[model samples]
Target: MRESASWLAPGRVNLIGEHTDYNDGFVLPLAIEFGCRATVSPGPEGMLRFTSAQEPDPVEVPVADLAPGAVPGWAAYPAGVLWALGVDLPGLTVAVDSDVPLGAGLSSSAALTCSVGGAANDLLELGLSPRELVAATRKAENDFVGAPTGGMDQLASMLGEAGSVLFCDMRTLDVRPVPFGLDAEGLALLVVDSRAPHRHADGEYAARRRSCEQAASTLGLRALRDVVDLDEALAKLAAEPDGEVLVKRARHIVTENARVTDVVALLDAGKVREIGPALTASHASMRDDFEITVPEVDVLVEALLAAGAYGARMTGGGFGGCVIALLDQNAVDDAARAAVAAATAHGFATPRTFTTSPAAGAHSVGAHHAG
Candidate 1:
């Protein structure tokens, strides 16, 4: 007996406001054209099997056996989704195919989790709302997969609208839509894959989260998102003997949150050109204060800007990944070539580049009736 269904989820690119999610800050991200698709079918109640076009071996496990580190590599992603969803079945099988390049900082993991979770919601008839789906997928990544990422990726993949950016509040999980007509406005969003990989479950990401938590506790505030007075809060934190790095990290969140709002407003007003400085400022803050951008990322930004991009910044979880650039549609190719040349000149990967437009949110593409 075969009861088959398929679902799809898109990868996301954060235009601004990086590293602020765990601190309960705002982020502006959009689903791109690349995505992951999962095909699922019913099997026994407690058994599960997984396969990916990207992976060589199929991962077989029982629902009850899913746990932190119980699965490894890319398979852990969908495994974690199943664990977090509490999916206990007699048997089930899934096959995944993706255009979302792995380790590109483009939220490929979230795409995988969302596609699987969304399909499960329909296949199992769970009836979860989009917001509930976001939480569930995020939990899968955070707890089951052992990634300490925030909810932005899941939310963007689930709730993203074509031609719009998602304005998400991490604290409330509230969402507001901002129009993104950059393409119609003769602009293009370039995603440069610098090809540097960083693990969110590792010490660097967790250490940064701890820093923000410490800053929030010390300032008597709920999260960095709650800080009202930036200068005053910085002065207060800078006064402590052991608070210099904390002060820097806190400042990035405090200011980065505000930058999200500003960028959204500009985008709403059809003033996309003016948003350039904010993007550059964000890169500077992340590079200087937050200390997340690497030389490769900085080079990406510099190269994009040098090629006449209106703005550019690193777009994912710091240590290393991808960078996003805003430029005239006509300039996209030159900018991309410049970035590759720049990366190559510095003894780095040649760099992969592409232009992306906002894409629709996760949805079902096909299903086969239960047998």
Candidate 2:
């Protein structure tokens, strides 16, 4: 029997695609260095215990009483994973510590859940593949936490590789690691946390998802990814009531999918800097078409570009969250200062900024066996 074990999973940032995942479109995301770690070991009979470095209090629940809504708040994420796994097991104690910022649109929730799930899978000797873990963690977020999100975050956290970005086809669940040698190119990916709260469970995100589904159903397609001719599709949608909004939503998805492909091609050709325009264009679409970006995010994106970022855009599910800017490594500090200055000038919350490259996926960090 395993006496104890620990696992780690990283948060992610989308370089291009946004609001396209649920539409079965493509996304390019990279797991960041910051993430969550979970340590697990046997516990008292019939009881599951959880503790977090971030939270002062410890939470304990009965193994048989684990269910959605049974555990609440931060503890719910780990408890949800246990519920979704549905495996008979002895009571366990799980301890977690994380540096991934909450409400930063960086997949903190996914990292938290995946870390716990990965630890449980290994400690119990359950031979679940990475894809299976992705499914289990995603189910925990969707069914247990009540967040309406696609599997991109979980998949990225599970499959990420060092020095590579994940190119995911949401429809096929196919993922490939694309080389992203930013340091070699004298470039950096600057992440500016706007400090504005972004919540996926909120009505705004669900509403955008509903709009996409409505458009797909009206177009007689499985998802927005099936739209072959954007012009024709938009024209057809324009004839319906509230067609204007649907046209914009569909346009963003179709064009964003194309942008993902273009960015991938540029990366393949080693034209890393050229992808900046596409990143900026993505933010425009999210702001104008999807109506997801808030003033703080919008201002930061603009400031990044003005301060010489090659390209900048808001990442993750956005009502407000983080913005990523790709630029020269030498210019990173200046760009960060400019973004913070812009936010403060606009009377918005002071933004936090950091730089990171692609990082490794979830894995076991340590373990011990019972004698």
| lDDT top scorer | 2
lDDT of 2 by residue, 240-281 (tens): 899999999999999999999999999999999999999999
- TM-score, cand. 1 vs. native: 0.96
Error of 1 at 223 (Å): 0.6
Cα-based lDDT at residue 26, candidate 2: 97
TM-score for all models, in order of appearance? 0.96, 0.98
Tens-place lDDT per residue, model 1, 255-345, is 9999999999898898988899999999999999988888899999999999998889998888888999999999998999999999999
**Overall local distance difference test of candidate 2:** 0.93
Worst 10 residues of 1 by lDDT: 196-205
User: With candidate 2 superimposed using the best TM-score fit, by how many Å does residue 237's alpha carbon deviate from the native?
Assistant: 0.7
